[model samples]
Target chain A: MNEVMSLLKNHRSIRKYSDRPVGREQVEEIVAAAQMASSSSNVQAYSVIAVTEQAGKDKLAELCGNQGYISECPVFLVWCADLSRLKAAAERHLPAGAETYESSVENFIVATVDAALAAQNGAVAAESMGLGIVYIGGIRNRSQEVAELLSLPQLVYPVFGMCVGYPDQEPGLRPRLPLEAVLHWEGYDAERSESGVKAYDETMVKYLRERTGGMKDTPWSVLMAEKLAQPARLHMREFLQRRGFGLK
Target chain B: MNEVMSLLKNHRSIRKYSDRPVGREQVEEIVAAAQMASSSSNVQAYSVIAVTEQAGKDKLAELCGNQGYISECPVFLVWCADLSRLKAAAERHLPAGAETYESSVENFIVATVDAALAAQNGAVAAESMGLGIVYIGGIRNRSQEVAELLSLPQLVYPVFGMCVGYPDQEPGLRPRLPLEAVLHWEGYDAERSESGVKAYDETMVKYLRERTGGMKDTPWSVLMAEKLAQPARLHMREFLQRRGFGLK
Candidate 1:
């Protein structure tokens, strides 16, 4: 593999950070790269808020499930799925008496996908600079508080948060489901996927035993099963609606 | 900028492809890179279908609103937001009578975000090796037929398609919204975003006029307003629910 491929395949989320500061210029460059990701019809319905201050980071860290790295990391970027700009654009330029702009599930998907794509680009750029990062989905645990803290307007919601800094700890790459499990040819193959999962369960059981010194050895299926049975962020639908998204 | 940042900033959708072929080895490498992208709680709730057969490509092209590049490209990849694997995992190990797994809008967002993050990584990997790519959101235009064609199981929905090959045309990089439009400090600044959009309107007007030889000289806001006012893929909500998603 080439350098880029090597870098990509070596990815491991870093939850610990060093004190080396990330300069503003680097953040700008990262955002520049992020702005270049593909958007649905150039809507580019996404925005990022970088929190570097102690109070802001502390509040964010507390809100995001008390993840200390969120405060320790030089940057905590809140990536948002934003359509407020599109609404502004529509209000400004839509022909008089034209159909009104309203957020639909389609727009919701478009904005969310756009946010993820751009954020991924930003993640890759950070890694390329020898900086490590981890995504904080706990950003959604209290979506209302996060929004209020960030002063987000209607049609704009924080999709996720990311912590970026030099690595203070080394972590092993978490294995993924085999390629056959996720990559299908022409069409999906159920049997192949089942077989892949069976094989991956064994791999995970062994990997966990080694990683956790046999303290947390369990098949991958067991963990996923537990996760699936529990409801996560149940307020997401209501919150999204409250934020003026997916109301169609 | 470094190599990766340079590449990311230089991205442009390639809608034309040369006659060169993409090998399975390259596809595996790309997928390997993709698998390394971050997933929320390591759910990795996404899958990919590679369509190389002429018939499959032709059908997908037709289904994707007749984007000729999808059929013409040497490799077309359909990326899916999948929860079926988690369902299967739940069935396999969930303490028998535990609450059954059901897809929710939260899962919907997680899966969609997972697919996009992986796809962006794959896009970057492909670009690193001297290939070009364009995302085809038109994949959602007729979700039912496309899903049937791919034999997607419940809880698996095509998020987007990507066409990859050697570039036959060198399209200029499409300028994005100014960084100031999307990047904020600590919190969102609507005033800055508005100003940025106003400045970008002038830039886009010149770009559109130049690109279209003095024709189609509308500002960015006008185009976005029209897009927002129109109903796009209105069936997405129904289609997703049918696919066993967003039903919580």
Candidate 2:
């Protein structure tokens, strides 16, 4: 396999990082790579904040569910789905005009997609440079504090954060649902796909057992059931609303 | 710059593709690269259906807003946010008295992110292999038809489609919002970013003028205003609801 393909296939989330600093030049290159990603209608409705200052990183780490690695990583980047820039632009260009555009849920979708695309590019670029990184979606767990810490404006929300550094440890590639289970041919063949799921459950069970040092392995299905059988995620909508998304 | 980085930096959305066939090996490698992307809780809740059959591609192309490139490309991939596999696994593995976890908007977000991350990896891998690709978000414009065409079940919605093949011609890297506009340092500073927008709008005006044979030479701000002033995007929520993603 080629180097890029190898990097992609061998990618594993790195939660542990070596105590080394990432230079500004590398950070600039990664952000530039992110800027190069495709944007919807070239809206580019996103922004990234590079957090290398110790105090700032510490505050962000606390805000993001106390994920210690966020502070320890050589580079911590917070990706924002920012409609604020456009809002400001509109205000300037159409002064006294009633902000005609709707900041609806669809707009959030576009921003989220744009941010995610750029972050993916950043991750790929970092990997190519022999750096390890992990995404911290828990940043959304307490969106309000994140917004406060980052001084995010209305219509600007942090989608996620990423930590980049040299790896202190190597984690195995987690097994995924079988390709057959996920890949539907002409139409979605649910029944046919389900057959593959049973086998995946078995594969995951075995994989977990090996990884977890003989602990009783949990099936992927039960874990998903546990995840959804609660109301933990209900706070997300309210959180978004409080963050000024007005997700109408 | 390395070949992969060069390819990434120079990437343009290839709306037109050649009829050259992408081999099965390349498709598998690309899918593997995609599968390597980070997933929420390691639950890879996404799947790709590679459509090589011309008739299937034609139907999908028609369903996806008559995008001619979908059929023209040697490989058309429909990326789906899938929850059915987990649903089935839960039904079979959970205790007899246990309740099934009803799919929710959170699940949809997880699935969508998973799908997008994978598709991007595939895109990067394809670019490294000297292939070109473009994302067709219009797949959502006719979600029901796409679902029917792809045989998708209740919880498996088509998020996007991708067209992949060797490029018939190279398009230049489209101009982007200036770094100041898209990169927030410590907080969201609209005033500070405005200058970047001013610069970028000038750059885009020049780019459009040069690329489109002096057709109007509209600035980025103007194009954005025209785009947001319309309510065409409101249909997305209704479409998602119809696809069984109860956004509550």
Candidate 3:
């Protein structure tokens, strides 16, 4: 494989960071790379908040379920699904008779996906520059509080966060479902998928045991079930509604 | 910038493609790169169905609002937010007393974002190999029919489709919003964002006029207002509910 392909295939999430700081020039290049990712209809419906100060990072870390890495990293970035800018642009450029659009789940999905695509590019760029990075989905646990902390406006929601710095620890690549289970030819194949899952469960049991150093012997399926069994306790649906999204 | 960063920044949606057929080896490499993308909790809750058959692509083209490119591309990949394998895995691995998990909007969001992040890598990988790609969001326009055609099971919804092949058209790098507007320092900047939007509207007006050969002289903001004024007419919300998602 080529260098770019090699960089992508050797991906791993970085949770532990060293004291070394990430320079602004590096962050700039990373964000510029993010901006270059595809946007739906050129809407570019997303914004990023970069936090470098210790106090701000501490508060954000607290809001994001006390992920200490957020505070320790040289920079913490909150990727937001943003439609507020679109609304502002509409109000400024549209004629008097032009219809004002209300946010729908569709629009929300577009923004969320746009943010994700961009954030992934940012992650790839960070890793290419030899920086460690981890995505902080826990920010969604208190989405409202995060929005308040970041002074986010209506039609904007913090979807996820990230930590970037030099790596202090080397982590092994996490195992994923086998490609057979995840790749279908032309259509979904229930029988082929069932077999794939059976083989994968066994593979995962051994893999998890090795990765956790014999501490957690749980099966992947059970863990997923436990994690997702309860409806998200956080008020994400209401939170988005309050932010003027999902109105349709 | 490094080669990866350059590869990312030079992205442009390729609509027209030559008669060149993407080899299976190339597709495998792209998918492998996609699988290397980070997943939330390593759940890896997504699948990709590859379609190269012309008849299959034709039906999918009709279902996706008659996007001719879907049928024209050498490879059309349907990326799905999948939880069915998890369901089956949970049944097999969970303890007798373990509660059964139900799909929710939260789970759907995770899968959607996961699928998007992977698809972006696939796109990047494809571009690195001298191929081109364009994402198709219109698949959601007829989600039910698509599910039926693809034989998608419950808890597995098609998030979006992608067309990949050698480029026959050289589209310019589309203009994006000014970085000042999208990148906030620690918090959202209302005044700076307002100024950025004004400047961007002017840039977009000029861009759109030139791109459309002066036939469409509309500003970006005006077009956004017009396009999103009507709520997504498709019954995606109801469709997801029927498919056993959005329970929360």
Candidate 4:
């Protein structure tokens, strides 16, 4: 396998980080890499706020379901799906424009994809620099507060957060679905693909057992069932709507 | 600047690709890097189908608004926001379960984010390998046919497509919005961020004028207005709804 490929295959989420401060130069490079990501129609409807201040990071950690790493990491970045800039541009260019360019579901999708692409770029760049990063999606749990803390405009919403630093521990790569399960040749085959899921479940179970002392003994299927059975996950839609995304 | 940062800073969307096949090993590595991307709660609700066959690429290209590069590129990959696997997993684990899963908007978001994050990783990894790539959002222009062509099951939609190969031309680095335009200090600030747009518009106008001659001389704001003024983009919701994502 290629060296980069090996790094990718062995990648594990690093929640624990060394006590190191990421330099301004590295931060600029990471954000620049993020900006280079392809945008929908090149709109680039996303922005990232780097929170290096301990106070701001602590506040973000609180907003993101009290994830300790958010405050501990050398760099904390909030990836936002932003449309406010375009809205401002439109207003400045065409004062009579009646098209309410607030957060619509379509725009939300664009911004989210833009932010995700950029953040992924940043993550890859960080990894290449021998840094470890983990995405903090829990920021959406308290969307309103996050928006306030970040002072996001009406058309901007915090999609997620990420913590970057040197890894303090080496966690094993989490198992993924077998290629057959996820990859379809010509057309999608649900039944044909389910067979691959069985193998994936076994693989995951073995991985969990070996790594976490069999605490999560259930197969992948059962674990997913428990997750979906809850209603709290559905709260994100309401939060998005409240945050100005009329996902109509 | 780091080599990776330099590569990113110099990144350009390479629509014109050389007629060379991307090897299977490279494909696997890229896909593996994609899988390493963070997912919402580890759901990993997405899949990628590598299309190497010319006929298949032609069909996809036709379906995706007849983008010439889709057929021209040696390697084409369709990234699907997939929830069918989870639905099947649910059905297998809890037959006659009351809690329906497939027809939910939350699941769609999860799948889209998963697909986007993974595709971004794939893009960066491909870039790291000295390959050129471009994303095809035009795939969503004809979502139903794309779903049918990919044999996508209910609750599975094609979010986008990616074409990866060596570059045919060395395109310059595209300009982006100034950091101030997108990044908010605290809370949403429309008035404060407005100034940044002016600077960005000047930067982009100069870039457009220089890059593609005066023919493609539309300012970023004008291009965005044209995109939003049309109803063609609004059809995505209906298409997604028909594909079984009950956005209610």
Best by DockQ: 1
Location of the lowest summed lDDT over 10 successive residues in candidate 4 chain A: A97-106
Considering only the true interface residues, what is the Cα RMSD of candidate 3 after superposition?
A: 1.9
In model 2, the runs with Cα more than 4 Å from the true position are: A94-101, B94-104
Which residue pairs come into collision in candidate 4? A150-B187, A151-B186, A151-B187, A151-B188, A152-B187, A152-B188, A153-B188
lDDT of 2 by residue, A1-248 (tens): 78788888888999888777788888888888888887877888889988888898898888778889988897889988887776666665655644555467677777777888888988998888878999888877777888888788887877779999989999998887776776665566776677777787799899989999969698777787666555445566777677666656
Reference contacts preserved by each model: 0.87, 0.49, 0.63, 0.48
Per-residue lDDT tens digits for candidate 4, residues B1-248, read 66656666777888997766688878887887888788888888888888888898999899889899989998888899887777777777776754865555567766888999999878877877879999998887778878877778887888889999989888777788776666554344566566777777788888888877875777788777656554445777787788778765
Task: Give the per-residue Cα lDDT of candidate 4 at B173.
Answer: 73
Predicted candidate 4 versus true structure: per-residue lDDT over A63-174, tens digit per residue:
8888999989988888888776667656656567557545555776788889888888888778878899998888877877888787776777777788999999888778
Q: Docking category for candidate 1?
A: high
Error of 1 at A168 (Å): 1.0
On DockQ, the stronger of 1 and 3 is 1
The residue pairs in collision within model 2 are A187-B150, A187-B151, A188-B150, A188-B151, A188-B152
Question: For candidate 4, what is the lDDT?
Answer: 0.78
Candidate 4, residue A127: how far the Cα is off, in Å: 1.8
Q: Please, what are the lDDT tens digits per residue for candidate 3 over residues A1-248?
A: 89999989888888888878888778778888899888888888899999998999999999888888898899999999998878876676665776665556678788999999999999988988999788888889888888888899999988889999999998877776777878888899988887777677788889878888878677666777677655563477778889988635
Which CAPRI level is candidate 2? medium
Model 4 is docked with a DockQ of 0.54
Q: Could you say which candidate leads in TM-score?
A: 1
DockQ of 1: 0.82
